[model samples]
Target: MKKVMLIDCCVRGVHSRTLMLAHRWLAEQERDSQVEHLRLYQLNLAPLSAQEVEQRKDTALGEQFAQADEIVVAAPYWDLSFPSILKVYLEHICIAGTTFHYVEDQAVGLCRAKRLVYVSTAGGYVGQRHLGEEYVQTLCQTLFGIPDFVGIRCEGLDLPGNDPEQLVAMVRFG
Candidate 1:
């Protein structure tokens, strides 16, 4: 079975609409793969300081990212971007010579994952304004060497008259 890493960046945990959708997706994916869930908030990861950057310590987080056969990130949209915790977790894993390396002055990814699925929920209709999705996709392709990038976004959840359950169901089926 393929090793799938599920990165949970949902700030609200069980109360988060994004997480509900993500769980639905994972349930389907689990039928065909081995899923490992990493909850960022529970980890309490801190942003890399200037001192930590210089030291370049070995981290289990980076190793986990590198070893996964596929990655599924569930992050809620916030302030036109994903949460700050997600950014910090990304920093922890995007280590040189681990997740990526330079060859002939060009960066090459060392990650085992061939695909990445980004799941998110937005309060308003974002449409083409998926900045957070784009950022993660770029990192997956350029830095992590995950050639296949997929994004599942459920928008307008917090808006009046918008049915969040129906939106999530659509993604679950389609």
Candidate 2:
């Protein structure tokens, strides 16, 4: 069975619209696939201190990324970006000799995942200013060697006179 890693970065947890959309997307995946769900909020994740960076501890999260055949991330847009917790998670997983390694002058990804799907919801219309998705795409494709990248986003949820549920329901994933 294909192993999929679901990284939940939604700060609102069960109340997040992005989480609802992500659940729907995950439900549509192949029935035989195995999903390893990692809830960021539940994890005791701390940013790497200067000393920890030098020590280079092997993390379970990095191992999970290396083992997965595919990845999915769910996060709500916050301050034009995803939550800081997501960034901390990335920092933990993007370890050298785990997710990626240096090849001469270039960095090569060692992760087994071929694709990553990012699901997000925004309070207002971010439009072309969606930096969170762009950052993740670049990281997955260029650094993590996930060639295929997809994003499902629902914008304008907090906009005046907009129904949040209807906006969230518009998200479609294959």
Candidate 3:
């Protein structure tokens, strides 16, 4: 069976609108693939030590990330990016020779994923301020070798007179 890596970075727990929308998207789109659901909040993730970096090629996280057929990342916008924990998780999987390798002194991706879908929800409007999404999209091409990058976002969920449920309901997977 093909694998779909679901990296859940919704840190707000049961109250996260981002998490709510992510679940809806997953139920509708990823019923066929085997899902490896990773909740970032529950995982004891941390910044890599020098020793761990050297051993990353043999780590399970790196290998699984490389082998995933597709990737879905669910995170809310924070500090113009994402939670620090997601950064830590990314560092763990970004192993040389696992996710990427140096070629001619330049980094080249080695991951097997063909597409990466980034799902996010914002409180205020996020017109051109998708720093987090842009960062991931760049990584998909340059570090993960993913050809297709999709960004599905529901913004202004907390704005006055706006309904979060309606916004999430209106979000399209297309």
Name the candidate that leads on TM-score. 2
lDDT of 3 by residue, 1-174 (tens): 779988999877778888788788778874678888889888888799898866675578888889999888999988777888888988888888889999989888899999898888888888776999998999888887888998889989889999888889888877
lDDT of 1 by residue, 93-143 (tens): 888889998888888999998889889999898866689999998998788
Model 1 residue 1 lDDT score: 91
Between prediction 1 and prediction 2, which has the larger TM-score?
2
How does model 1 score by TM-score?
A: 0.94
Candidate lDDT scores, in order, read 0.88, 0.88, 0.85
Candidate 3 residues lying further than 4 Å off, grouped into runs, are 53-57
Q: List the residue pairs that clash in candidate 3.
A: none
Regions more than 4 Å wrong, model 1: none
Compute each candidate's TM-score over C-alphas.
0.94, 0.95, 0.91
Who wins the lDDT comparison? Answer: 2
